[model samples]
Target: MNAHTKGKARSTRVKEGMTVKVVRGQHKGKQAKVSEVNTKKSTVYLEGIEATRRDGQKAPIPIHTSNLFVEAQK
Candidate 1:
């Protein structure tokens, strides 16, 4: 497995479609659902919150797990 895949396998506890809140970044304090978990890319897609190329303009992207804190309530 690649480094990205290995890392994700180790770090991620929650699966896709879970709710997560951005703890850091321009979108900080924003809540979004976990869209996709890319172990090979070590990236998680938070639907409707991540930076996108719009009107040919770029904005600061959402934070990664390093900058994110998952709030899981039992």
Candidate 2:
């Protein structure tokens, strides 16, 4: 088994599909649904939250789980 699943459960506070509020950064105070979770990196992708590229394309932004607070679960 890999390091992640080997010994103990991770202390991740957020999970996929959970509603979370941004506590910091440019998107602070915005509430969004958790679209994905990266336990290894401690980051989450919120639905409808993205950064616009120079070419006008939007890409999912990964926010550290610490920067978000769980609002509700879906």
Candidate 3:
């Protein structure tokens, strides 16, 4: 299969702009709007949910789609 076909086949239920609750990890129990979806990595990025760098900059963290549940739609 080609890269595009593989990516389409692995599409996640979660979509951008949807509110999702973290099911596992340090951020568990927190709810945030989905900001981005990395289908190839099977991960999703949520707004206001990220890691702080030592320099005080917030870095976007990619959480596995399996670790989040759709709480609401945009």
Candidate 4:
């Protein structure tokens, strides 16, 4: 399959509290700060970044680190 077809992925060594940008998925183009780290699942919670319903409530979701590109602060 092509890169587009593949969804979020997980990589190693990323810690919590790092700033990151969405490189893929529905949340693409959004910037967020890391909130939590899950080594076993290889996922991280980005503050203010998540799927939402029509009411704007956050959906239960966690994007993989590989799907996130670390961003440098100004």
For model 4, residues 1-74, the per-residue Cα lDDT tens digits are 86556874534366777778898998898888788888899898888866778998877468987888878532
Q: What TM-score does model 3 achieve against the real structure?
A: 0.78
Best by lDDT: 2
Residue-by-residue lDDT tens digits, candidate 1, 1-74:
68786655334465577777777767778777777776665566777864557687644443456666676522
Q: What number of clashing residue pairs does each candidate have, in the order they appear?
A: 0, 0, 0, 0
The lDDT for every candidate, in the order shown, is 0.64, 0.88, 0.88, 0.77
Model 2, residue 64: C-alpha shift (Å): 0.4
The Cα error of candidate 2 at residue 62, in Å, is: 0.7
Worst ten in a row by lDDT for model 1: 58-67
State residue 47's C-alpha deviation in candidate 3, in Å: 0.5
| Local accuracy of candidate 3 as per-residue lDDT tens digits, 1-74 | 78686765333478889999998999999999989999999999999988989999999899999888777777
RMSD of 2: 7.2
* Candidate 4 residue pairs in backbone clash: none
Q: Is candidate 2 or candidate 4 better by lDDT?
A: 2
Each candidate structure's TM-score, on Cα atoms with residue i matched to residue i, is 0.58, 0.78, 0.78, 0.66
Per-residue C-alpha lDDT of model 2 across residues 1-74, encoded as one tens digit per residue: 87687886544478788889999998999999999889999899999999999999999999998899877866
Instruction: Choose 1 or 4, whichever is better by TM-score.
Output: 4
Query: Candidate 3 overall Cα lDDT vs. reference?
Result: 0.88
Which residues of candidate 3, in runs, are more than 4 Å off? Answer: 1-12
